[model samples]
Target: MPTTSTGSKSNPARHDMSVILVTGSYDHEIRFWEAWSGICSRTIARTGESGQVNRLAISNDKRFLGAAIHKKIHIYDIGSASSDPILVLDKHTNNVTSIAFNSEGQWLASGSEDSTIRIWDLRSPGNIVHRTYENGAPVNDVIVHPNQGELISCDQAGSIKQWELTDNLCSHELTPAGDVPIRSISLASDGSCLVAGNNKGQCYVWKVNDESTSLPRFQAVTRFLAHNKYLTRCLLSPDAKYLATCSADTTVKIWSISPGYDFKQEKILVGHQRWVWDCAFSADSAYLVTASSDHTARLWEMASGETVRQYNGHHKAAVCCALHDGAS
Candidate 1:
């Protein structure tokens, strides 16, 4: 455990529904921020510089923080007295690219450079991986479906796999021609659409058949090109109303979607001086946080595309983050 590495003292007077915002960077440190005040409430030191934080995920109950680094995942008990990680989960032969949890927080799923996805039982003992799936290509991201029964994974080979946990089988697979390594993936809240962005900055969207129980189908919805630059990340707002994307072009843009899921560019957010790596919307989708190569995490007001507060602390590029508003 380490002392608060950067800012204000740890304040315990926040409301029960205080939003938790955690950002990790090339600095090898994870800092927790009070999103409203721009104060860093807690900082967890990452001693070994195996790699910068590639991604982060928070448990549903807000009891744990998961940080994905090179070949390893660190689980920090944010609710506990110590700032040190409570557990270390590792096994990947290369970088662990993405980390996420089931809606119930009963399982944690990781995607890795080793081309595998593993599900760990958080409540279990040593070596908690309860199930594993092999894709044979470096996995860039893994996202648990809102249904909580399927894991959607995209990999370097540009393959999309829907692993059905309840049935213990792969329910569907998509292998795009000239597969160009999909880098980011996002699923709509209603399980209505799925989107994946490739290294070429091309985004592919599909309509999902949520009612299907076996051999589900993803009909091609639409494909659009985000010019500017290569894609870094694409995220759908929690309410499923908008799609936000980050790119090497150094901009974060929002897209408006119709009731039928037709997407159109709504606005562009510009402030970061370098490549924008990731962005996540607040619980109400009224605020947005973006990580950038410019070494900052910015909070933005979505409506006016104005910067609300700039969280400045990371010594290096801020690459990824996790946010929870603590509301059901």
Candidate 2:
């Protein structure tokens, strides 16, 4: 027998009820937001002297959150009440700028101003740090190869280096120009393309070939000037349809990824009053989250170029963000 009700309200937010969004900034705190609402559901303190979260990464299983901080990577349980980290792995001497987990959650990689790239075996008893590879300059960005056992790192001295995890050495290096520091690096969804942005506001593109071999080759596909000011981050949508870039010019630009890595400018997102530091795409790539120096993080609808929600709890600039869509 069914109980009849006069009326029932529809729950539109149920689809993203379990989605997680963690925003970090210079305020020394990481705030987790409700997916559909602009409300901060949880806030955790994470910082040391001269250290705020420069980057954030979530494990593939969505069970752990990793924050890249000065000289260490703090691992926290996503569902825990305690603000204390479950693990603190320290090996870096300078501030950690980037951290990411492998697709299988077995390895964690980090790059830092310490001028080193390291991989940690998460399955080990202490999550032992592996062989340290020197980049000769402060590494600004790190990208894990989709092939599982490789890492591509870019440094402040304009070197794109590929490290072979099997041989524990650098197999190849790509230098577009001498001494132009690269700010960010991103890989296309199918692993066919690699793109990097530099402090000079130039973007470089390469078609990844022979990746299945021991020596992967990156052939330069295209190079273009992107922004008037420094580029902060370049990201490819998970769906492979768009490449999004944030810059010191205070804008996020979306570009279409056409054949042969030819990019066509699709839209320009404008709202932030200051530098745009970071951005993350929703699972469907229909929406984007942008962190800006204006002390806010915004959710934007891709089609209309309009902000749908503004997250406004950070005391200072929002520098980094990580979004996990549970329904995807």
Candidate 3:
């Protein structure tokens, strides 16, 4: 709601109650900003030896910040600017690319360039409960389902694997017919369906039925050729009414899904200067945030399809980003 200048880089994190946490990249710090006012309430910076931060995830309670660097996961106690991480997870041999905290905040999931996914128990430092590997492709993203005891992982090969945390084994694999490399996968809040975008500039939605035990498969309910280039990211709105996708074609499209049976496309959101890497909807589904290779993140009004605010200034391409409400 608050207005700011373009060319400013801020890593945004959403809290439980919908408040947003905004952090500045390249400047080497994090800031807690009031979502509506856009005012900085707190500032934390790297103090010791760590330099640049690539990705960030706040704990469920918003008390801790988990940052991914080249090869380590640094856990920082919020409000403390000290350079030291309360816990340093070094299980990934390659760079830690992404991290996420479960709804309970009891477990942390991390994916890395090593083509593996690791789940860690927050109660026990350095205790990794599960470590699973893909044949060779790097694990690009991992997300914990809202209600189910499952985690979904996507890799460079465009394959999506669902792992049951309780058993710590892959329960299902959703592979496209053409084997197009999947860029991102997000589950609807109801846990009944999943939407995935691939490098082929196509997006597919799968209905997850629990009955089939043979091979984990999904019936493709809807397909959208939204971009001419690779589709980099896909996000489902909180209400599950809308799905937003970003692509290498330098545009973002919003699709409306019919309520009960058939999931169909309804609209398109088009605005961006270059390839869009990531896109997310506000908690209310009224606004959208997009990060692009042009080194800027723009906020879009969902209803009107207008560019509201732009956050720029990253020295290099902006790869991944999120919006935080600040309750944590």
Candidate 4:
């Protein structure tokens, strides 16, 4: 279990979980933290020649960590800490915004600002499995289906496209009638629904069916004006029972989604002095972690809407964060 700390600003950032990774805008470094003690574990500075680190993705086994910088993807071997990435993939023509590894750790997908998505095979060296494109907006986020070989991608146009990884073809396109650009996308663990957050501080839930046809269809289950400001990130609980969203409005909300996927606002967590940029849930769904422009990351109790602890050490804004259980 992770221990709670009650110290002042003099103390280092605590690491309650196994490993914590943070990406900063000004520093251009991906800093690792010891989860329970809030201590700086290691700092992986961008290679002497690379641009700022924009995003991060850890493999399912926790043996590898991927960082997106400029138009490249840097893969680091976290099994041993040398601060140097083992492989640097420079194929995207524009800034690589998001990357995700499938549950089996066999495939890796990267979404770029160039309006393209690339799928790479982990088993083969320098092998590109699939490459697909969306109409012409930066592909901001990409997520693989929980149980199938399909990929879901979202962009600045608030449209969702489904691509079949094996065939390297876009199977379907889902454009919600409105024009709010989607900032983030997340799929439930059971693969029953897909949730998207937009720039208008709204979240939309869609029921997805795989058995329907080649072009999978979606039905709008609910739409929530979650906050007064733009939404930055959204995540679904491990059990697919709740959806958590963070926004520029300086609040994080947890919404109940089970038994019919209703958008009942259960709790609104607040403490950050600036925009809440990112939020995540623990593996067991017992805790919530948030990264903000306030130069601090906070851990909150999911049920009580109380901030359990705060990790404040970054001199600048903590743009992105990832929680690693360190199973490997």
Output the number of the lDDT-best candidate.
Answer: 2
Estimated TM-score per prediction?
0.92, 0.92, 0.81, 0.88
lDDT of each residue in 1-328, candidate 4, tens digit only: 2534446689854434355444444457777765555566677765566576667777777777888878988888876668777777787889888888887677688899998888777767764544555547888889888875888988987788888767777777877735668888999888888998888887888888766567447777888788889898889988788889999988889998767878788998978888888776767777787888887877788879898777766777777777655354
TM-score of 4: 0.88
Model 3 lDDT per residue over 1-328, tens place: 2333333247554322345544434345544444443455565556565545556777767677787766778777765656567888877788777788887777788888798888878778455655565536788788888764788888887678888767777877777745677777888877878888888877777877664456345656777675778888888888888888888878888878886535555556666677787766666778877777786667788888888666645555665565754244
Candidate 2: tens digits of C-alpha lDDT, residues 134-217: 888999999888887788999999999989989999998988967899899998767888999999889999988875677548
**What is the full ranking by lDDT, best candidate first?**
2, 1, 4, 3
Residue 89 lDDT (model 2): 80
- Minimum summed lDDT over a 10-residue window in model 3 is located at 1-10
Comparison by lDDT, 1 against 4, better one: 1
Candidate 3: regions farther than 4 A off: 1-18, 23-34, 37-52, 81-84, 127-130, 133-136, 211-217, 260-271, 326-328
Q: What is the lDDT of residue 140 in candidate 1?
A: 96
- The reply for model 2, stretches above 4 Å from the true place, is 1-17, 46-50, 212-216, 326-328
TM-score of 2: 0.92
Angstrom error of the Cα, residue 215, model 1: value is: 10
**lDDT for each candidate structure:** 0.84, 0.86, 0.70, 0.77
Which residue pairs show collisions in model 4? 13-38, 14-37, 14-38, 15-34, 15-35, 15-36, 15-38, 16-35, 16-36
In angstroms, the error of model 1 at 209 is 0.8
Better of 3 and 4 by TM-score: 4
- Give residue 33's lDDT in candidate 4 (0 to 100): 65
In model 1, the Cα lDDT at residue 120 comes to 90
